[model samples]
Target chain A: MLHEPATPVGKDLAATYKMRLGVLMFLFYSLFYAGFVAINLLNPLLMEVTILPGLNLATVYGFALILVALIEALAYDLFCRRKEQTLNNTQNTQGEGN
Target chain B: MTIIIFLFFVLLVIGLSLYLGKKAKTSSGYYAAGGKIHWGVNGIAFAGDYLSAASFLGICGMIATVGYDGFLYSIGYLAGWIVALFVVAEPLKRLGKYTFTDAIDSKYNSRGIKLAAAISTLVVSVCYLIPQMVGAGVLVEPLLGIPHGWGVVMVGAIVITIVATAGMTSTTYVQFLKGGLLILFSTVLVVAVCVRGLTTQPDQGGNVPYYEYTTLAAVNESGQIKVSDAGWQVVELQDIESAKLTFAKLAKDGKETWWLVSEKDGAVELHETQSVVTTRDGQRLINGAPASQDNQLRQVSNIEKLRGASDASTGSVSPIELLAAVSDKDTQINLWKEAALTDKDGGKVTIYYQKVTPGNQVMRPGLKFKVQGTPLERADFLSLMLALFLGTAALPHILIRYYTVPNPASARKSTIVAIAAIGFFYILTLFMGLGAMINGVLNPADSNMAAPLLARSFGNILFAVISAIAFATVLGTVSGLIVAASGAVAHDLLDRFLNLRMDDHQKVRAGKISAFVIGGLAIVLGILYKGMNVTFLVGLAFAVAASANLPSIVMLLFWKKTTAKGITASIIMGIVSSLVLILLSPDLFKLYGLDPATAPIPLSNPGIVSIPLSFCTLVVVSLLTGEKAKALKLAAQQ
Candidate 1:
């Protein structure tokens, strides 16, 4: 079983990169969610406006938020996969050189 | 027939449990499924574990009754998973062994951390268990014609068996099966709702509605009946339940009495009933008559006309059209009004009222949250939203799932999959809730029945399928909670804290024993909290989690200066403060038959307050004991 963490510097590099990306996505998504809540609290009547022929602002905004979440998840995965691959290549070359 | 189907589902679950039990011999196998669960299956299992009775029943009911407010929970819950994915998942997988306590205690061998984390896990688990058990009990009465307590015990027994026998292995499979089934059936229901199209009135199949609408502002007290609005003097209260109800007894102002008196669009209107029946066989009766074998319940539909539509009915509108139709300000919908009315002697009687609201108003947030409500109400709304947003990553059951996957990468992948599955299911809830709302299927007595009842409107077969899935939802969640709780007891308290030198076999045995005890405690509490809304209870569980667990997890991972003393102090402070705030909140006061105004805490959700306090406690304590931080480095090296 793996006892300690693998290569403190390597883990830290990935962790820092991932945390920055994650925090950005989290904050962005949170702001989007909070916007909806703010509308409800400040000017609920705005929700009644027709955003589409059959859809209102509230319904449109709600579904839009769900879409954003799915998009963000996909983005995070792709970016992290790339970062991990780059780290692996550097470590492999270093091992071969040694 | 419902009993047979329900039994079949239950038996299938148990069979899977026993089959999986064979693989879970070791403590790791029993507690964390040997840390070998495939990311895809574990991802679905995460959904199964997270999407408890609250997601399935409570959200649907809330949407059915209140429209858009219910879906807010879905947004918050799914949002929380983002935090888990980005923040906790990989680190938790990398660090933790048997339990969440293992992760927090990775840097320190402190007894205080073990005790505090274990106690917090227990508290959160028990609080979470109540809702699932309550939801199970709610399902039994309608599905099996049994009392609520039997349903609670039934679920408790099944979950205990699942935990005690196979532990995480059985739990993962059970969760996977139910999770897939829940999404599948919910999709089927949503499709049915779409295909049925938008209609002003549900097709009654020529049968008349049981109770008539009445405009008479009549008072029924003991044997005296008075219609003050019509200037009618007090008369003998007619026993409508026993005797045949006649128009003559209810007539005033030369108008025959309408059976239902409704307040719609700020105007009180009278409505007439088409049919009423009384049954003696304990079989469910629709509008005073016993239901047919296949057609058991009457479908509820919106009574008011659709905005800009030619007539009272639209032949068949698409899903998008349905949303548009309801969003039209000209559209009128009948929203349920349930209030607890106390009589002169302080006896509480729940009165069911139907408020006909405009579509514009129904589709907004103020219905339950109330912008115009008291300051306490607004605070409660903000607090609940805060709790749901922060609580998802903090839940004991949810956090434990991270330990099931083998590696950090797998953990992250599984979380992404869970988000996809859970997010899709929540979107479906909007349609299901609306389907129930407009169909006239809501049981005013219990809104939690909205989803299953909506399924019944289509056919008894669909009803049985949905109810069984709901029952499975409860089982999957309760078992996950028990496993987490048991892990805390055996790994953290017994072995780590008390210095019990148990081998692998003995450790697994200890977990099973604790599972049994916790399951029993859950059953009793579930019975005690019967009839409460499952989703509301879940919100409280989330508040406790965010307040007590999240700070410790987040600070330990990111804050380099964090000491063992800080983590322990923060957890204790968070748990005690949040629990006390919740107990003294207006919601609890109301539950205890006291006026809500009597509660000491103004805000019901403590996350808004307690979470920050916990973070501050940790930071301050860590600064004071910075020298001890060197110990964490040594422990990490070992």
Candidate 2:
């Protein structure tokens, strides 16, 4: 019946930054994802509409999702590294001042 | 020659494992590769670890057999990596030492957390193992020309050795090789598919039983349609405009089979194609004769018409052009759909008949998923997608890979790499599946062989190499699962409960023993769950993982009031509820020789219910026990 976090996990300097970015990305992606499922459920005929030569909305939207995931991953990684670098620099300056 | 190549790959993996076995002498080295793997190598290894037989064989097979619904599985699977990347990857690396259980239990030195998380890991790992084992069996049939049962046993034996000897080190390398080759060869195959282009009639199986379908000129008035010649009777025409098939009885032959009923311009045409049948006396018959090599079910995904292409071929068409050709209104793909019935002699007859489907229909959502069906079907689709998305972050095997990297940053970097690799591979699945569909390489008896068979359709050497890589795909995933399970047993459960002082060597010995046992169990389950769709089976595993482990992991990280009891309770509840719902599902009901319609549970997947239940249970239990746990914690510290 232990109640506390087994580790001093929240004390990490980057914990808050990581959590905020992660949650924001998660919510944003999930919202975009909902439209895919919603179309398949509500009006599936909409998926059959041929937007590109032989490709319909279903195929187009599906490919877009996979493509978006890779773009988002690369974006997330880039953003995290930049923030980490800034944090490291700030910590060094503070350490020298102290 | 194929055997030589296959054996070479097998021996290479084994030799590598035995060589690396020296490093696994210690527990840390055995469990997490001594935390020395480079991030770049680990990234491809992550792809190797994540893209199991389910991704390579199952999704491709699904797409080939049922059309676009298989692509839906790929989409959902890739979507899951996002959750893994954004939420769990870095924190899991920061906290975990060996197993995923280690991460969750780091804050609480409580026996409850150890027991619960360990059990959850074992459950999810085994559930995941079944599909890979099943996929192994399916691929082995075409790979080594062995029976399905032997294939499962062979995989179990090899993977057990992999896990028991070098543990994580060899497993990681095996996965990296598999991931790299799978993507490379798949790209080559897609290129081959594009260059070969689409053909209307793919006589790849040496023209086996190519029955010329006779179109009957039928004059119909009102609801009932009749034919004066050959004693053919259509009881009801039933909207030939939209229907893919219609029923017809031939009075002359009295054969029980469906006729291809479609509307042409303003007239209705009835056509007959070759059928393979099996009688109650165990007679295998094709076109009402004893089935032989010359008259058996051929490589079947044949296109009836190659619209927008010249000379019945669209040679060297680009990917887009190929898709466009298939989507043409005049384009038709001939697929074999099987059905069973009792004949006039009161004996059973299984019939595989031809059904001509439009290319546009093949690329849409309604083939397998029934998107236009009732609310239940829609709910099932949503449930599957939800489970897939949430489940990736919670999988014990995937979580353990986070520990293989040097630091949290490496873990983050490797995860993005995995995303790039896996996402790219899944995109290739759409082409491979469609390629198999048009090129005539699909095996109707087992859809799991679609990807391998697609290679076989083009070249023998290509098939052999692809099959070996696919076999290694199973080896890699099974290796990871066994490692995770062994860690749960040895590091989390046995170490805590035994309370016996054991060194690294002794602990490693315990882990190897558990890996062997879990591998044996996986083989048995793989054999039992034969004929079921591998992707669907993997989907069920995802549901179980998302329900059982995810709520606990997410709650532990975010909810400060999460008690040891609450975590334990949630894990147990999630496991129990999901298993119970699955057991009562229509699919399992059919498995038990009962009518699927009679199953108590309406939903096919348990995630939508069991996941929320797990979360609610955690919150309520944590609330109720917060003060009690606080007092106990203070007392223990004092």
Top model number, lDDT: 2
- Please report, in order, the local distance difference test score of every candidate based on alpha carbons: 0.79, 0.80
- The DockQ of predicted model 2 stands at 0.34
- Please write out the lDDT profile of model 1 over residues A37-86, one tens digit for every residue: 77876777888788788778888888888778888988887787777766
Query: Chain B alone: TM-score in each candidate?
Result: 0.87, 0.91
Report the lDDT of model 1 for residue B173: 92
* Candidate 2 lDDT, A43-88, residue by residue in tens: 9988878998778888899999998988888887777776766675
The interface RMSD value for candidate 2 stands at 6.3
Which pairs clash in model 2? Answer: A6-B107, A6-B108, A7-B107
Report the Cα lDDT for residue B448, model 2.
83
What TM-score does candidate 2 get on C-alpha atoms? Answer: 0.90
Q: Model 1: how far is B138 from its true place, Å?
A: 0.5
